[model samples]
Target chain A: MGIPIYPVHLEDPKLQGFYDGLAAGELRITADTETGEWVWYPPEIVTGRPDATLEWRTVAPIGSAYTFTTVVRSLLPGDHKAEVPFTVVLFEPDEAPGVRIPGVLVDADGIEPACGMRLRLKPVRAGDHIIAGFAPAQ
Target chain B: MKAGGVAITGVGETPFIRGSDDTVLQMIARAGLDAIADAGLTPADIDGFVVNQYTGHGSDELAHVLGTGERRFAAVADSAGGTATTGHALMLAQLAIEAGLATHVLVPYAIRSTKPGGVYAFHANEPHKAAFEMPVGFFAQPTYFASMANRYAHEFGMTEEELAAVPMTYRAWAALTPGAQKREPMDLDTYRRSPMISTPLRVADCCLTTDGGGAYVVSAVERARDMPHPVVAVQGIGLAFNNWPHGVLFTQKPCTFEFPGEASAQRAYAMAQVGPDDLDLAQIYDGFSISALVQTEMLGLCERGQGPRFYAAGHGMPGGRMPINTSGGHMSGGYVPGINLLIEGVRQLRGQEGQRQVPDGGNSHATTILARN
Candidate 1:
């Protein structure tokens, strides 16, 4: 099946770094310039300080498979309908203790997914859009 | 003047079934009319309106049909999910009545999402959906709950038999409910034969998508005593949000297999000046059987990871301690989101549930907590 273009809102300034990093094959995160707090999902401001400066920080792509589920039946209409039994994994970055990110576990279709398995980011082009996912780290 | 001084004077619900010929708007009107009648009040008495935000059904439309002239308060509960909507509405109504903003507040919830293509395409249009969720094929509601079930099973050593017993318990209660969608007896054998919608979650584990509605009439506790029905006090009210970012998939939750129920219930119980031991019956939200278990656990009815065993042992059945979802709950009772659960809670407290009534009902509470991504 041909890869379909899933819509991504790059117009959001808080989330612009995420999409840009995916396109660049890097996992970019937001960190507080003043408090040194690492934010996995982008936010408008730091934890407590609205005046704290924020900047994009790149971390190692390696993470552990926190938890996951297999979609045996497709709830969507388009190309996803044909992609049944695909594994969706939530990975916990080694650098970020509490933050967890969700993505598809690419490759290893017949392999049963296990918790605490090591994985790495694998951003690839799907049609005109870049989709980010995770694969077992070498 | 106190927060818990408000009361649910009347309760009404449209038939919970697989298909309804009535439109959502018509159902809302009927429920409102029935509630007003139950409360022994005229439509002119209602000056406040609250509705579920999902249907885009405005309070003005409801107020117009109900003849609630010159509405003083009109609002919609947050449509985050089915769990917290009812609580949010009741809390708002209580505040309005306490603040002297409105005398009688009408809260009604209606849905037609069970029909063909009605609920299957319920995709959240948040900025996060397009980025994380949709691309991974986590489209429907069950997939998210299924993920929670899998993680719960792995972490807590939840057995398949334990999981299957939940629906069986609800079916036993539903058998007594006349208007319930699934009245057939569902034993463990039947549950095992059901197909898998997702891993660790079978078809029997999910809630019904009924096209129906439910409504409640709220007024001052003093006025409720003089009304037509028994006064069910709006005792304790608590709300907790898990701070999970929108569009984050279920697996990425800050705490999987755990809702903010502990904190919310603690606040509610404290406000009511009652603990889990004080509750005689509970109308727990059962969007899925697992959700019911989680809610029960978090409510302090049983220890964590021991909910399935507690439910299976008949403690939640009629005539048992802490009878739950006596109206069959969302699973077998026809899911009108969480509004029906609230109505049932009031019914139990009022001794209105005929055969399903808890024997000499004790302090009753209706509550739901959901942490969505």
Candidate 2:
């Protein structure tokens, strides 16, 4: 039999906002917690602090490229064909207490993602799914 | 500096190989025997046993194979990979010594490379693995680290040339280590063009997978004084975890220097009463080049985001401020699990590195801190 699939449930409002932002065009969002401010991924409660105050706030989508890697092979099936190389990048947003976000590069040609290149987060719709991606800032 | 100290008296390792005919049981026996012999003890003296469960070898089975008369302690630790193995082993040895549970403990790992078995299957069962991660084809560790590597490069303005410098420098040290699997020098251009297993990481950036075992014996300092080798003391150790929420995948802002590593280093240095400047040599784990860089910063050797610059400036090389991974490390040295790094640290402290020895000469005192990513 194939692997069993489980539906992930998100209950926290902050986390819900994070996924909602991903679904919408808001590629970058920040969360302020009592321990400290952080960015959400598969969002949830801030770790360590028992009484963490997490709030979802939107910010500028522009970020500076921190690092980038080109993947020649897909780790998952149907993600990308063998010929199409995928570029994964860590983009540092231009906000206070700079946050690093990981995403894929879309529409990047000839220009290789470098350590300090500026890029903008581009949220796209894959069928009905919302995914965040990075492209060189014009 | 005697609040609570443990002594590492004996270290042994099986030669790393691409493929081996020996079963996991056989590897454990061989490595365990060598470690006990290194400690100048017999199986009767081993009161405790510690091993990594993920390696597929069971701790109870290992203790039975070694023929311990009446074992006082047996532990199969998870969560700590290579560096954690050393830290946990030392911790258990110290506890046993103090608690009157057992005087001697053997920590061994027998992992078979080239054979895809054991915990690799467990990854398929993880909730995250089945859901968001595996569906994206992020099957193995390379992809996870590749994502981080890309982010590190984009955030820090680091270059492949700069990134390639870490493995290149490690290979130089490995060249001096006769036991190293890949001892040849690696040039930058060759490193840059190396097969890209994942972006920001190349074939060279990753640690080699090999079949081997590394084991060490620990005992109280008084008991170890009678042994042939000088004792390498475990001065301090610390561990932390990244509790990033799932949806915040890309934005989990972990400070390489500040999180588990740096915090752990601070505790270790405090316990040892030593600072980064006092380190005669180090055996930082190099599972990946960025891992080494992150660890160096966390260990207080350099400032945040300064690891690449420190490596680029040749500060982490053999003759530099703090000679690191003198045993060739996991990067160039065959990965016999992580016990080799600890063994190398002990060897460096004992002045056994020979040509790979640091220029400042022999070291009577050393501290080894192991960090897992």
Q: Report the lDDT of model 1 for residue B334.
A: 83
Model 2 C-alpha lDDT per residue in residues B1-373, reported as the tens digit of each score: 2433567777888888778887767887888889898888888888888778766777677777888657888776665566457665566667777787877888887777667553244455544334333432344556666767665654666777788888988898989999898987799877876888777678899888778888888777777677878666666665455653233333344532223676666767776666777766777777788888878777778887778888888876877877777777888997765678888877776667789876543222222442110
What TM-score, over all chains together, does every model reach?
0.87, 0.79
Cα displacement (Å) at residue A102, model 1: 2.0
Q: DockQ values for all predictions?
A: 0.38, 0.26
lDDT of 1 at B40: 90
lDDT of 2 at A50: 44
Candidate 1 residue-wise lDDT, A1-138, digit = tens: 122244564436567777688888888777887778886555555557778777888778999877777776656555555456667777788987667776777866556787778899998675577776888887
Runs off by more than 4 Å, candidate 2: A1-68, A75-81, A89-103, A110-138, B1-4, B117-124, B134-139, B244-259, B359-373
lDDT of 1 by residue, B102-205 (tens): 99999887888755566755454555555566665555667778778877776776788888878887888899999888988888789988877667677788
Q: Candidate 2's C-alpha lDDT?
A: 0.67
